[model samples]
Target: MDDRKKNKEAEKVTITPSDESTSEKGHLFGLDETIESIKDAISDFESGKILNIAIIAPSYAGKSVLVDEIVNIYSHEVTKVSFSSIITDKEEIPLSEDQSKIMIFDNCHYLYMRKIGGFEVLHAFLNMVLEQDARLCISTWNIHSWNYLGRVLDIRKYFPVQIKIPPLNSSQMKEFLLSEYEDGEILFVNDVEAEDKQIFHVVKKPLAEKATHGRIKLYTLKVNYVALRSLLMNKGTPDETAESIIIKEITRISRGNPGVAKKLWKKWLEYPIIKTSNIDKFSPSINIDVDSRFILYLILSMGYIKKCELNNIMNWKCSVDDIRINMILFELLNQELIQINDEYYSIRADKLHLVTKYLEDCRLVW
Candidate 1:
């Protein structure tokens, strides 16, 4: 590893045991409709309708939370199986002979890979789901993988009841983020500089050559305003409190993703206070070749993957060797587009939106 990699490794944040506990108890901010839909599906199943459900959402958008909620509701009848990594063998899937009437599979995306002959495990799993008539099966999938498989194998037909998780709005985000804290416990500090807080700034500009001389150019002060979209959004909201402003900014930046919002909240929080100035607005520029783009898509689709897994996927899919794979991952790491935690590489929480946008633009992700 180079110095930059060493420095990045050194700067990585270590999550405490308490943080892990809090994360495991994830909040269900915008999943009421989803839960209702699941209830209706369960009711249908109870009425002799063998309708299997597929819950689809992007990574870190609370798919697991939704699964946990389902298990909680049907605690006496649901058997939950969660896959933490890619499942290459059907034997890896659990076969429960318990009395539970409903089977819930979390992270079903792991059942298949994007490479050729990768659908064997998934095909077997689907057959098992189809052949079983005694239990109602509910599975969760990454939205991108779901789309791809739906197009390729018509996978949607297998699951009649498909529920897509919705994003939380600004108000909902505020409520969810502050749920664990006392009212007014965390101070929202507005520490933006006067110039940055204003819609316009006066900048000095040099005149054209016709009005300029060597080292003596005519200078003029020009009034320049911020982006039009930003101005319009904040036009009639001058009376907004610091807390409201911070929440709105977080909602917009996170694109209403609860997982992302929580990560941002932790990043901005300084014990009992958060400052507007602490919000990160810097977007990393991504410019990589086609090979690197595909690798990035894999990382995004998997949420987090080990380097060895990346090598295996690349070698199977495109016959790319380990050395080239390492180079591409290094480039991505050097740009700070992705990060490594506990030997798993994943898109940085703060750069999730930027990375997703880039992949969407390149048609690497749906």
Candidate 2:
């Protein structure tokens, strides 16, 4: 076997779709409203309303799962196809003949480009949708791709029914994450876990400060990140349960992303007995240059990427020089924003929030 294949496989996570939350089926715990909205939209489609739905969300926000659910619901009518990367042509996409039918294209971002003028397939698909009859098409897109396309092609105008998946609220996030566990089955350790507990009150420099702190007003109750986490956790409250508090903090940090929240919870639960105090303390902010951020985005979009494929991804994006990209990757490794085992690279489960937030602010992620 090749040395690359001989190396270990990347870590994996397993989720039970059937063990979904109370609100919605599957892992989409807090998306009852969205599901309802989608059903209503589909009903309109059935009525020949011809509503084209664009489900805009970030990676691992259950975009595929949501579409899959809708497909299962309308299996007799909807035809679904999934894409992973750039698609130059629409030859492979099957068009529906029935005017009242539904067509679903997941990862529809594959049709557009970030730079400019490279989306012939997207244009063709839009043309097909517009020129055709009363049939409805439902497509999913990365928030970043959708934003870029909005500016480039005004794509939102076409998707009259845009279902932007909002982050799950505290209650919804709690139910979603805890759905897998039986009542009080998981015992949590009631203490904050940190490498060093010493405090730092100094004003951070632009390098570190810019990434973590957005606004600053002197003596305006500037709170340290760790301290703020401590404050929001509702610690020592007789009424609040540790599990609820932990889920609240996780939802806050994860911004209601089910995948990120689940991964964070798994990482925190290093042992069978959950024993982590301040969940926020686990979130670490790391600074990165432009090249590094680009690399991080690629890995995140794909969720987990092969270590050997780093150069391929960088080149695909036409990123920095190979040597420089290697240097940035090494720096990322040093920062522990990502983990490498065998021949795969992945974002550290705890750092999902930090990474997602950074990309979101840049308007790069969904």
Candidate 1 local Cα displacement, residue 149, angstroms: 1.1
lDDT by residue (93-168, candidate 2, tens digit) is: 4454443367777777766544345577788888887875666788888776677678768998889999988898
Q: Candidate 2, clashing residue pairs? A: 191-277, 192-277, 192-278
**Residue 279 of candidate 2: its Cα lDDT?**
59
- TM for candidate 2 is 0.72
How far does residue 116 in candidate 2 sit from its true spot (Å)?
4.6
Where model 2 places Cα greater than 4 Å from the true spot, the runs are: 1-26, 96-100, 192-239, 278-285, 297-349, 359-366
List runs of model 1 lying over 4 Å from the truth: 1-26, 96-99, 197-227, 316-320
Residue-level lDDT of model 1, residues 19-43, one tens digit each, is 2322233477878888999999999
| C-alpha lDDT score of every prediction, in listed order | 0.78, 0.66
